[model samples]
Target: MAAPRWDLGPAREPLGLIRALQGFFSVFAFATLGGFQGSVSFHLSCAGSPNISVSAPFAYPFRLNLATFTPSLTALCNRTWARDVHLVGDFSSSAQFFVVVAVFSFLYSLGALLLYLGYLHLYRGAGGKLPLGDFLATAAFSFLWLVASSAWAKALTDVKASVAAPLPYCHPPAVICSRDTTTPMGTLNVSVVFGFLNLILWLGSSWFVFKETNFHTPPAPSTPSTM
Candidate 1:
């Protein structure tokens, strides 16, 4: 067989443009969430002692429960006062799920773009199967994006709550502890936005893909003159 002809025309169409956007947003969604590294800070003060700074660092796959923060030894609060302080919850599951979905979406869109650009003939020759398959994949990813984004959003809310709540160790008598600051999660917030954008892109492309499938074909007109 002759080598498949390369065509750039499809790359300019709505379906192709949407696929490109999906791939673009998918990259940002995963990168922002996966590469995140931040910390929550606190202030510790005991009666007659100056305030001490403590920080608990955390990164992607946010298992805050595993993260520990210990205050520096002060004259009033010695090593005996030092203890591992853990944040309240584990949100790794939702974070990982969101990142994984975005990564797979990027890979799929990249492959689909290659097919549209380099193997147009083969895709068209697949007897409606290719387009139907693409439509199904698009629908599936749309649902996945909805689920992953929602779950991650809820998880992020819990993460903020866990960080903002007073540390359990701060409850002792005469020893005062309070949250100082938390590294902003702007990147992760952007990730959530991109995730929803991907969902919209995939859903919008589904109509174009469905048009190519047999399911979307209009029925033949009736032979009215036969009467």
Candidate 2:
């Protein structure tokens, strides 16, 4: 008797959803458009008779203008200062956070695209059965992305705090005071939001794969009749 063959079924909705999400992530990661791109803006102001203000805008993955404080506030107050006080914070911390997000997203997106090709008949035209190796890879990478996204979100919060927190020189009794500082956090916030969205989608895909593989079994081959 001939051995049994694995039966393939129609593609599941969850799998298609996962493929769609993967494509979306790939675009965002490569283009760095929509939520992936962000900028930080800081304004320095000294409180005295006439308020003096200077604004600096910083783009992510490029330059980060944390906090620029004019050191020679006394000179400015006395009209003896030739240049504006310069204050800056180490932007490496936040830059690193964004870099990690971009790199991982790109990698995950590429993996997902390859898997999609396999499923769509573009690559190997693999059947509907979810392979064990693929499942394991998906689960592992999904978890990694989840954790990274969470970290990215937390890092954004930290960046916001750092932007708001007064620097050492700006302590009370200091001539140069940080009158007001604000950062448009929409870009980073959107990235963090999408991260959670991707995490949920990945978990759902994993669960679907697990159920399909565990509950459904291919029919066994029937014995051949003797002529």
In terms of TM-score, the best-performing candidate is 1
Candidate 1 wrongly placed segments (more than 4 Å): 72-83, 169-173, 218-227
Q: Model 1, residue 71: what's the lDDT?
A: 48
lDDT measured at residue 36 in model 1 versus the true structure, 0 to 100: 96
For residue 147, model 2's alpha carbon misses the true position, in angstroms, by: 1.0
Error of 2 at 24 (Å): 1.3
- lDDT value, residue 147 of candidate 2: 74
lDDT of 1 by residue, 85-107 (tens): 67778999999999999999999
Quote the positional error of residue 73 for candidate 2 in Å. Answer: 6.6
TM-score on alpha carbons, each prediction: 0.88, 0.60
Global lDDT scores for all candidate models? 0.84, 0.51
Give me candidate 1's TM-score against the actual structure. Answer: 0.88
Model 2 C-alpha lDDT per residue in residues 1-227, reported as the tens digit of each score: 33333222222456545756754764453244233433333333344444565444444543334434444444654443455433344545444554465466556556655554444342222342444455676687577667767666676666666555553444333246453556566666666666666667667777755544423444356899999
Residue-pair clash count for candidate 2: 4
